[model samples]
Target chain A: MSRPRLTFLESSLPYAVNAARLIVMDRGMFVADFFLATTVPFLMQFLIWSYLYQGSSISRSFGVLSLSQTLFYYAFSIAFGRLNNGYDVVSNLSLNVREGTLEPHLLRPVPYPLQKLADFMGGGVVYSVPIILVLAVFVFIPPVALNSFFWPGWVLLVVVSQILCFTLSWTVAMMSLWLVRTDFALSLLTTSAAFFGGELLPPYLWPEWLRPLMSYNPFRFMISAPAQAIVTMDGGFVMTALAWTSFYAIAFGCLSAFLWRQGMKRYRGAGG
Target chain B: MKKYLLFFRLGLAVELAYPVDFIGYVFTTLFVHLTRFLFLNGVFDLTSTLEGWTRRDVMVAFIFSVLLSSVVDSFTPSIRTFVRYAHTGRLEPYLVQPLDARWVMIARWIRPGSLFIFAIIAPIAMLTLSNLNVHPTLLQAVGGLFALVIGAIVNIAVMATWSLTTLVSKRDLPTEFIFRQVMRLNQLPPSLFGYKALTALVIFLPIVLTSTVPAMVVARGEYFLLAPMLGAAVLVMILFMISFRMTMRVFDGSGG
Candidate 1:
């Protein structure tokens, strides 16, 4: 057997270190995030659901799952919340735009959006690991087993859906060109996602009148669909989830591309 | 006090200058609150109570959380400003001034957007109280006001600690992000947390001191909590003083 050469991609190294440094350098922040992002949200959800399920037998099976499955579903839902932090590209790009660093980068040979996306993915990989580890704890503590037949597809859907989520977030960030202050938009997006995206609770549990509309929303696909698919392991559900995610990914990608072009066209640098 | 009022007036003017942005922000905040209320309502729909909190209790908690956060947010500087000052060594200018550096920072950053929120939420909170006929007694009102004062102090002290972190770190420390996350606890009832978590929120983070205690005082006439809540707030202020002092010791102006 031939030994393969170990090669590190030099271009990608900085963002990896950047990501690692983000978590490692700030011990206080890491600890805070571990609790606030992972531990507390899960605890909050678990407690709420526990109280919610108490003495209520009407929804005996929580969205096509038994009691044990329902516990895992909610656990996984909380896990999905942590996983969503990987998309920091939006905030980073908006900051860069505001600080005027983006002006210099406009003339670079590589597309600014693509480069930012790559840098973001680099950080995403590093930032997301601990969250996944936290998720693993929740997955095991309750010992919710996945559906073997559908687990593989569900995993695929999650990966793809995450990319779609990133794209949608990035598109929102590009709007900072006009908005200048993206804080309100970002806050709205996050708040909307938490509520409508099924992060706080499943859309299945939201008001019935709103369910049909929420089911079509991209934010729901961002968390609920993948989370449910992994647990439910329904083939048809998995396929639909993939289809909706792809639709969003493509839609958001085009929107981002268009926005980037428009922002570039409008760019007047400090010296310009 | 005159300086603060002058700065606050200046802050108000700056806020009102951007009419469109300000209106947009207020609307967005209202939308966010509406969604949260809906989510809370949805949760209650599943169960009559959450962690022993009735819908009214939770709604009141949510309102008070918004009020307290708005009170803090109205004065607190954005994390970006902290990063900018730290990076550019602008702290020197503030430091050299006759006034306190922290006060200077606060003077410049009184968020009008947040002030608007206070205007909106305060009325809603009172209306909700009256609608539920909470009709806080004279003692309850006084106790709740006392809680608010101490809670605001604790809030400022805690934010000051976060702001002072810029003295040591070159980059923004996610102080604001972590703060927003921690403040979410304010919207939740104390019963949602167990003993350990409750203790952490009460003594360490003091999120419960911000909204829950005050809301309870008014809503349930729980004036007995005044002493303990005030004590916790004082402890937090002292802790913040120590943290700020220590942070100053390691501070190298813009050298980080």
Candidate 2:
């Protein structure tokens, strides 16, 4: 009898599960990681913004209606920031390239990028739990919840943003094939995204001239756009976010493919 | 002391070996600081003060925070190296040497790349001070320098204590991640935190001493804080020494 062949989902599911397993392997570390990275930063932001908005006059100056809304924006932004983070993608891919471990990955039945994508999605599955809890608080809690009519649009923005974030990271990580190190590049990418994506400062607060750049950046779609949609309760903004994110996803996806091919050729030339 | 100086020279040489990487790091540091400067400018544009801290006062705090952070970054061992050494028994060689093993672990992996950030910080600090039209008295300047040295001692002691976790834990925790996040709290004026939170941080972690206290002393002439800051630094160093002794008892050749 012929051996049974596995479907794409069947083949990829194990990789995803393994990645998720690795993330939650140490329960103590997992909790500490979440607390330190998310809770502490969010609390700091809350303190700073609360101090800033102590005066009703200054709250108006921030263009944010109330302290609650500003706090909600930061809370969701930090959660989404964790969801869309790509530091591991860059670090892992660079390590593989540097150590010639790409050979085994290339020879896998599934494509290399697909394997990485599965792994990324798998890890994201573990991370998405906190995000869901955060959203639940905002949705079910009477006091903080905004009865926004743009829930469906916000959902679409979230889906598209994940793909865009992954593609952008993959494209950047491909630089490791040529460069000796990608840590500097990774730092630059993350810092720029945090600034432009409205995690550090909201788009509403940006100067008029810088508004265009903020809107057009890839990171804006991944982080701020989804947070902004819910915070501002703007239906039109959600559509814009979906469109921009999808466009960048496709562009970066293609760029990543091209780079992978070029990198493979170089790898072969160098006996990788 | 001479051997530690040699280690520093070795680190500088190693960093210079990869000029492109060094330059990239410098650029990234510049970009991060520039964005922070712009963010502060945007906040100040809307309001002149944050918790009674004027734009100039906050800028002073930010500059000192960055400077202290750079000092920590320059000398601290990369967490990856620490973990690798622990896992592979590479640290065993250093333990048997005549030098202090704890200092060897740190001195061997110094990243001089962070020092290049000072080049970017100095120019920005000068321009910001000029723009803010703030001048510090000579006494305040001296106090600020003294506070900075004490702060560095506190910060390093805290980190060194945290680094001992690798000897006890089976899996390495993201200690560096926690450290960086905690360090970021330095950027804000310590006064922004509540009395309880500020007291806890000062007594236990002393992170605020690294940036906020010095900034307050220099920018606002808050000389009263200097004595407490020194006390905190001394407390932290003692705690670190006790922890180091306890951890060393359990540490084996490889990760325990």
DockQ per model, Cα: 0.49, 0.62
Q: What is the C-alpha RMSD of each candidate to the true structure, in Å?
A: 4.2, 2.7
lDDT of each: 0.69, 0.78
Say which candidate scores most in TM-score: 2
Q: List the pairs of residues colliding in candidate 2.
A: none
Error of model 1, residue A123, in angstroms? 1.6
Candidate 2, CAPRI quality class derived from DockQ: medium
In lDDT terms, how accurate is model 2? 0.78
Q: lDDT tens string, model 2, A1-272?
A: 99799899999998999989988886677787788777877877787888777765463567754677788788888778878888778877877776566678888999989998889888888888778877788667745444455777788788788888899999989888887467687887778777888887787687888878877899888887888778777788888888999999999999999998988777742322
Tell me the lDDT of model 2 at A180: 49
> Which tens-of-lDDT digit does each residue in A18-116 have in candidate 1?
766766676676666666765555566666666656675346545656655666665566656555543366666667766767766666544566656
| Per-candidate TM-score against the hidden true structure | 0.88, 0.92
Q: Which residue runs of candidate 1 sit more than 4 Å off their true CA positions?
A: A1-28, A55-71, A138-152, A270-272, B78-80, B87-89, B194-200
